[model samples]
Target: MHKTLSVATRLAAVAAVTLLGACAGMAPAPVFSQDSLPDTVKVPAGHRVVLETVGVGEITYECRAKAGDAMAFEWAFVGPRADLNGRDGKKLGTYFGPPATWASNDGSRITGTQVAVAPAKPGSIPLQLVRANPATGNGAMTGVSFVQRVATVGGVAPALPCDAAGAGRKEVVKYQADYIFWKPA
Candidate 1:
């Protein structure tokens, strides 16, 4: 019975590893370029390419009072989560927060402002043009000047009816997008 239990445990571990490998293998390759960016994501005249990360995350929303008469669900701009990955399917870091931050594995971090937006589809979250904060870390994010989020998928919250009774109700919606960083040429 001891031997049989050990064999079953080994088999389960092997199956788990195989499943993880398959998921990694199925990650899509990065496929966008500077030329493919939409006009809304305007890179300044002197900025040059730095790096791009493609990954998936969530966009959170909460029910809040709109104007004076009604309650509506709107983006809370915080608490969304994403795993930023490299072309080889290795995780490099994470993207999160209301101001929208990309924190890299090398201890570098940066935040950006949404200067422009173009909706990905009818209901999906839009691709965005973001202006980066001055680089503060001495890692991959050093000297970063601008960032663009494009080729997004998912991340839209359901259109549930919200009223005064539902104020403060929160929901997390799933999403995906490519984040491209740039620096002055």
Candidate 2:
């Protein structure tokens, strides 16, 4: 009886260890990955490029526009954005947690042949929220389907503080994208 009890105890310990290993090896959360495809963006006008980053909470875009264009670099850590009716209310992340960036020429008015805006990097979320329709004189709005590829969020695409950056900002990994926006013809 004593030997049988000892064997049972050992088996239980082994089972517990196996269970723990399985839990620890669980797949990573749905947080966006660096290889994740980027959302599509359309160039809206003709002029020079202006970097535009839209972030919420601590998640911010690590971005740059055409090289040598000082005005081509801009990033924003936005708090929140709402519409006139205020119907869709979601978490700050749900709205802009995935750090996405875009660019427009100074004289751009939001209409033209769209071009590739930027390239994905190691620690970045490359995205382009192209407002398909430029404001029309008739006050009409036509939005394009959020494209995923030509523009993307390609960094440590954090889902939320609870995601890959919760331990601390220092512990979080950041990816930078190489953007390529040329003048529109």
- On lDDT, the candidate that comes out on top is 1
TM-score of each: 0.75, 0.22
lDDT at residue 78 of model 1 (Cα atoms): 44
Q: Stretches of candidate 1 above 4 Å error? A: 1-31, 70-79
Residues 3-118 of candidate 1 have per-residue lDDT tens digits of 45588899999999999999988966544466766788768788877787876877878777766545344434446789998866789989988667889999999988889987
- Give residue 20's lDDT in candidate 1 (0 to 100): 96
Candidate 2 residues 1-185, lDDT tens each? Answer: 35455888999999999999999999954422224443334443442332222222233433333246644433323222211111123211112222232212222222322234445454545443332334223211122222222332334434443222222232233332222232333
Candidate 1, residue 175: Cα displacement in angstroms equals 0.6
RMSD of each: 10.2, 20.5
Q: Local distance difference test, per candidate? A: 0.79, 0.33
Error of 1 at 39 (Å): 1.6
Model 2, position 98: C-alpha lDDT score:
20
Cα lDDT for residue 131, candidate 2: 28
Residue pairs with colliding backbones in model 1 are 77-98, 155-174, 155-175
